[model samples]
Target: VHIIICFYSIVLLYPQKNMPQQSEAIVIYTGWERHALVGSDIRLSCSFFSWRWTSDDVTFSWSYRADGARDSIYVFHYTGGAPYVANKGPFRDRLEFVGNPGRRDGSILLKNLDYGDNGTFTCDAKNPPDIVGHASSVRLLVFEKVPIQAGVITGAIIGAVLGLLVLVVVIYYLMRFLVARRVFNLSVRSVSLCLGLRSKLQLILYGLAVTRCFFLI
Candidate 1:
């Protein structure tokens, strides 16, 4: 009885050794917001990672919810190497599956978007035992004309500032060079003038000495 009790305790303590472990899937998306222009097409990017091996059995489902809508409707579905797009909704003919299940991509393209298409998009993926995970979502913003991104504007500003600084530095160096050359020329002219004056003084002194010697003789 004691031996049996000890065996049961060991089994209970090492239960993981008797049972295999399963990992859950992880869904990825391009953040919580995406911007698009009206009457233009946009690709909703999505991918997933699964601990299990990839196969055709991997499935994907895309859904959408309007700005204020409480319920979301299916937009696209894929399984068994085939796709089933929405056939009777606002996205009926505008949704296209552009992803490959073999590569774990669940991206979709929405064409000819309208203002009403501004909403949230969700992507869900399943790979057999890795079917349990949170779906990824991205909110879409439809605009008449998409505004320039802050990053682009900031980059342009920084580039302009850097260019201005470079121009200023170049101009400063040029001015210094010009001034240095002028000062060096002035110094050379002063040295030449001093030497000329010394030579004239020497000639005057020699003439005086020669006149004195002739008188003494």
Candidate 2:
């Protein structure tokens, strides 16, 4: 019997050291003009170019302000995964930390948006040796539902249509009345001329008959 040898092959799924290239600074992946419906949730994101190079002790904070001169309102804060602070400010009960700090994600969730929530939101993502360049900002817009607007618009359209129809009907009747009155006036003028002629003829004939009777008597 002959001895047979088999060669084994190994495939590397993940690299042992796959460090992403460092970026100039962290970037907020979420868009700027973030709009949310009232009583809904909105997610604001902040992160660096590479999570692998991010620090585990990174700190994330979110703040908001409706005016520039007023003090910033704290929304949320976090140091790492599962360890965070939903501030005792306006958004205490409605803030959620949905970001993955292990992956360098610093996104926060704001729930049950209100009228006062519409303002400029700022995110701070601070890591060791890179604390100064991890800030990003976004604006939030909250909208409410208006049930009466549709009815008001529909009523305006229907009222316009009805008014136009009434105007058309009034014009039609007015023109018809004017035409009928003109015809009636013409007919009356002709009847008056005929009656005048008949009266003249009857007077002349009566006079001629009286002359004849007188001559006969």
Candidate 3:
């Protein structure tokens, strides 16, 4: 009697490429110039582009220059199973991961922008050889509300300046018209004298000259 035994082997498969990828991307973190006024809820974003993606366990880090201290602002680690987020400080809820790891668009978004959140930001991915990117700054400027009285005063000043300009222009035009009319009246009188017209014609010309003068005045 001969006995035969059959056995089957099972193989597990995953994406072969599993390594920390190195990428470089830059984002306009500050989004505002120094001393510029900005409103609340302004968003802050940082990007990391144009870097190679290797199959190595990687960690992403965000840093800021505050009070002359280089602190770990936020950290994201990519283990084999799932992504892990390490809470650094102050950015527990304000930071958002805008890009997915496999896509390599490592960008972050920060919301509820505040004046205290102004400074230069340094972002990098922690692969074997650190892949670093830096933003000039990330500024959260606040716009102060204009006082009602101050606004009124400024409006009144501008109105007064415009009124003065208009008055000067009107006076200039009036002077020019008067000089032209005076010359014209002189000519009219000389012609009347040379022609020696009737009293009625002289009276009519005089009435017209008086009407023109009255309107000008």
**In terms of TM-score, which candidate is strongest?**
1
On TM-score, the stronger of 2 and 3 is 2
Error of 1 at 131 (Å): 1.0
lDDT per residue (tens digit) for residues 1-217 in model 1: 9999999998889868478657575655545788898999998888887766786688889889999999999989998889999887899999888987788888899999999998999988888767788899999999998989898999999999999999999999999999999999999999999999999999999999999999999
TM-score of each: 0.83, 0.50, 0.40
What ordering of candidates by lDDT runs from best to worst? 1, 2, 3
lDDT of 1: 0.88
The true-versus-predicted C-alpha distance at residue 177 of model 2, in Å, is: 53
Regions of candidate 3 where Cα sits further than 4 Å from its true position: 1-39, 47-61, 67-72, 75-86, 97-108, 113-115, 123-135, 142-178, 197-217
Clashes in each model (backbone N, CA, C under 3 Å)? 0, 0, 11
- Mark the regions of model 2 whose C-alpha exceeds 4 Å error after superposition: 1-30, 50-52, 67-69, 80-82, 145-217
Task: List model 2 lDDT by residue over 117-155, tens digit each.
Answer: 888888877665455464678888888862345668999
User: Candidates sorted by TM-score, descending order?
Assistant: 1, 2, 3
Can you list the residue pairs that collide in candidate 1?
Answer: none
Best by lDDT: 1
Q: Give the Cα error of residue 65 in candidate 2, in Å.
A: 0.9
Off by over 4 Å in 1: 1-23, 214-217
Please state the error at residue 87 of candidate 2 in Å: 3.9
